[model samples]
Target: MPGMGFGIRIEGLSKRYGEGDTAVDALKDVNMTVAPGEVVGLIGPSGSGKSTLLKCLGAVIEPTAGKMTVGDEVIFDNGWKITDLRALRRDRIGFVFQAPYLIPFLDVTDNVALLPMLAGRSNGDSRKRAKELLEALDVGHRAQAQPSQLSGGEQQRVAIARALANQPPVILADEPTAPLDSERALAVVRILNDMARQFQTAIIVVTHDEKIIPTFKRIYHIRDGKTYEEAGQALH
Candidate 1:
């Protein structure tokens, strides 16, 4: 039932650092919208505002100005509307980093299940949902294995599964395929695409990997704190 409204929307978003005498603008009037069940790409070079945009969307940092809406609610309009940012991040926004960042101490199932568990779901229900996500991601056979025992691709898949465990309306993936070869990178993108469609989650993958860049249906290119939108080949 998540993603009931527009998946993610941003308008006139801007972020500034420091005081007026030494202010640095990291984002300038950026606007974007990602619909439910869509997979889009965010591409930019170093110091190009991609990180700032991601942090703002993830609620890790606040923006100087603009609006952000997710699903049916407006999270920010010039300021944060949600008081419980921790719960918002935990329950509504999922993150996938370049590294797997799995809890080395926990098995695959537990790693994926922890999000829902923290969100107040019963352990039994959380683990069941985790197992189902693992099966969907093709990592169900390794449910009992620790992070160290899995390959890079499998670890990424587990990370993806963890991101989706909360059924968040929006997923933010940061350089997810930077560590893989062409084949494995494409495989990861395919899994992300499948997951987006299956769950009706809007996904934005921030990546520099050229191998999978051409696979996006749409792309947002950021440079000098501004973004340009373009269409890409919708490769499966």
Candidate 2:
């Protein structure tokens, strides 16, 4: 990976599935850019290729064409510049889904530490990093608690800590507030914004929740495989 700033940029990105006659164009000339410490919303209806775009950004799937740059490094242009997709994802991209998705057998500390551990860090160092993140997220009190013992909000906080463990430049969050009430949902967005600024991380949130939509400073609305950028009201 080349040394670069903290952000992600995508230009003319497109994804296609199947053969010519049976082909489906999932994304068409999609363009997006997120700056470090900024939180943007990615809103789209069902079957609008939101997931496809996420997968491409996450390096879970290869795009058929376009350019993707993480910070100043060109990760994908026509084809991936780096050979190890798994390592690329693990090292550069963080992800938060609708559910907490914590490991059932591990406690909160170990759950967040698992990412660093998988990346070859020593157990002690990984746990140390996890503890710091848990403290930052205000979940340090539950560091020893099992996922089963945690409240929904606590579990989600731990999940956010895990995503920030590596201090990745970009985090892709998909409907992270879906399971929470209005208050908790707004709380999640607040946390995301705070974390982004604190860590200088760029975050793109994919959501359909109307309650938090107005909270974004900028939003990308995807429909029929294209994206339109809009300025948001950005609730404080």
Clashes of 2: 0
Q: Write the per-residue lDDT of candidate 1 for residues 1-236, one digit (tens) a residue.
A: 12456789999999999987899999999999998988999999999999999999999999999999999899999999999999999999999999999999999999999999999999999999999999999999999999999999999999999999999999999999999999999999999999999999999999989999999999999999999999899797
lDDT of every predicted structure (CA atoms): 0.95, 0.92
- Candidate maximizing lDDT: 1
Global local distance difference test of model 2:
0.92
Q: List where candidate 2 sits over 4 angstroms from the true fold.
A: 1-6
User: Candidate 2: lDDT of 104?
Assistant: 99
RMSD of each: 1.9, 2.6
Question: Residue 202 deviation, candidate 2, in Å?
Answer: 0.5
lDDT of 2 by residue, 92-129 (tens): 89999899999999999999999899899999999999
Candidate 1 lowest-lDDT run of ten: 1-10
